[model samples]
Each structure stands twice: as structure tokens, then as C-alpha cells.
Target: MNAINITSTEILSDSWYTLKKISFEITANDGTKSTQEREAYDRGNGATILLYNRSNKTVVLTRQFRMPTFINGNETGYLIESCAGLLDKDNAEDCIKKETEEETGFRIDKVQKVFEAYMSPGSVTEIVYFFTAEYTNEMKVHEGGGLIEENEHIEVLELPFGKAIDMITTGEIKDGKTIMLLQHALINKLMG
Candidate 1:
């Protein structure tokens, strides 16, 4: 039996992504029902990738300004994160590959999918596909800083895997997806 039945959906905002207020009725296991309304932000699905070099024990990351984090407490508003992009009309693999080249300048032909996750399940309707790929200096074709028309000014950083891991404890790397990928690398020994 379905526990939730959506009654009506109201569009709150569509200026950027879509923000909707959804009203629903949920039946509890104990034979109780309650009406509720929740706001969900739908920005479509995305894919993120960690580019690592096992020989050098290094990982590639990008730093960019995030307006949301700025207002929420990030003094600089810049976040270091894995290369990621919205799926748009492409599949997860294709999107991540394109994002990797655009954000990190590394044109990787092969990628290993790590997992899929909902970064925020409470309100956001986005599931991020996580991937990892081995990279080398020869793979870099250009200086990647994201799309100019899109107004993305990304700074690329290549750091030692160990140093990147330590950044997690020092609060230097705070993005959830980046942290998860780093931890995944550490746990799976992707560096060594």
C-alpha cells in the first residue's frame, strides 16, 4: 500500500530552479492519517567525479564561489569541490565526463561509478551520481575554468591525497560531495 498521496503542488519559484510546495496526505502504520505540506527544490540530477592519480597520490579539485554558502556562513563563499555538473539531457556518465574536461581540464576516457546519493533528502529533489577516474598530466588538454557564458569562474587545484584528507578535519574541505568522495578514496585505497 502506498503511504503517501500527493494532493496538490504549487509552484513557489521558477526564477532559477524550480521550487514547489507540495501538499500530501500520509497514512501511518497505526491507521492514522495526517495532512502535510513540504517545499521541494528540483534542480534536476547531477554527477560528480574525483580525478585521482595513483602514481602521484594526488587528486584534482575545483574552487568556486557559491552564493548559498556565502549567505549561510561561508566567509569567502568559495567552496572546494569535485568536478560536477547537471545531467541536462545527457546520461550520468556523459555528463560527468564533460564536466571533468570543462572543470578540471582532464579529458578522461574511463570512469568508475562509485555510488549514487541524495545529498539532502528533506527538500531537494536531486540525486548525485558519484564517479572516480584515474588521470595523468598528458590527459590535460586545456586550462579548465568552466563555461564563460555561464559565468563560472572555477579555480583548479591538484593536491596530495593525504593533504586533501587532512583538509576534511581542518575544515578546509566542507562540501558534502567532495568529502564523501575523499572518504571513499581513503576507505578504498584509491591513492595507494
Candidate 2:
């Protein structure tokens, strides 16, 4: 089925990020009918995940504040997550690798591709590219986090496989891509 063509669009908000109102229509593959015009967004590529294997049977996650969740009665809204960032560059793998080193202080190799999917397809167009990399504790050369001037306060968490599951069930691990990476590794027996 061919995707609908954009008929018209409006700029809702444009800053560091952007929001748009778009109108489009879909032509059914079966030629049964043509759907009416619909409105959606065109949020560019904006999210990714970096999975790290410690070689001793655990993964490294990070805790950080999310303003949206915080305002939704989440209190501190600190979430446990993998080394992740937005996909603004031309290369997804390169971007995730740089984010892993910058956010977790781990220099890794043998980056393996996993799944690439949307983070929030219903409202937000956040497509996430997931990955896995084998690493050791020795790879750490510097503390990982966003620059302080950006108001980022991250806490690194090195947790066992089982503990990561518990965190997921308890809502401590709220990021979708992070959970997906953990589950993917756990299911495939890739982490050890």
C-alpha cells in the first residue's frame, strides 16, 4: 500500500525540536476506496539506544530526569536506561557509538545491529535505532553524561540481568528503547 501524500501542513512549534500539523490521504492497495485527508506530524529521527555488555554478566544503565514524566506525578522521574541519544546525524551506528562513549565512558567495538522501530508512532515520530556492543570495565576512561550546562544529571547504574528485569516491572526502567534492548539481549542469550 502506498503511503498518503501530504496535501497541506502547518508549523505548530519550532525550537530545538519541532511539531507540525500535516494533512494527507491514503489510496488503498486493493483499489477499494481512497481515504479522506488526515493530519499527523513529521517529527524527524530523534531517539536511539546503546546496549553495553560488561563481560561479567551485566549491563550498564543510567538514571536521569525526564521533565514530562516528572510533571505527571512521577516525582523525580529518574529512569534507568541504556546509553541513548537522538538520531540527528547521517550515520545511526556512529551516532550511537559516540553517545555510548560520551554517556557511559565505555569505548566499545563489534557493534551489532538489532532492531529499528518507532518510539511513539501514534503521536510522536520518534524512530529509534537499537544496538548492542561488547565491552569491559576497563574501557571506561571518563565519566559519562550530558554537559552540565545542558542541565543533565545522570547516574550510571551497572546492574545484573535479573535486576534489570525487576527494574522494568517496577517502572524504574521507563524508557521504551532501553527496555527493548534489555529484552532483546535477554531473549537471545547475547549478554554474558
Give the best candidate by lDDT: 1
TM-score against native, each model? 0.98, 0.86
Candidate 1 per-residue lDDT, tens place, 1-192, comes to: 639999999999999999999999999988799999999999999999999999999999999999999999999999999999999999999999999998888899999999999999999999999999999999999999999989999999999999999999999999999999999999999988
Task: lDDT for model 2, please.
Answer: 0.74
Model 2 residue runs over 4 Å out of place are 27-43
Give lDDT per model, in order: 0.97, 0.74
What is the model-wide C-alpha lDDT for candidate 1?
A: 0.97
Q: Write the per-residue lDDT of candidate 2 for residues 1-192, one digit (tens) a residue.
A: 566767777887787567777776676777554545433455566435545565677788888887778888888877777887776755788877777777777777658888788776777777777888877878887888755776777787878878887888988788887888888887888764
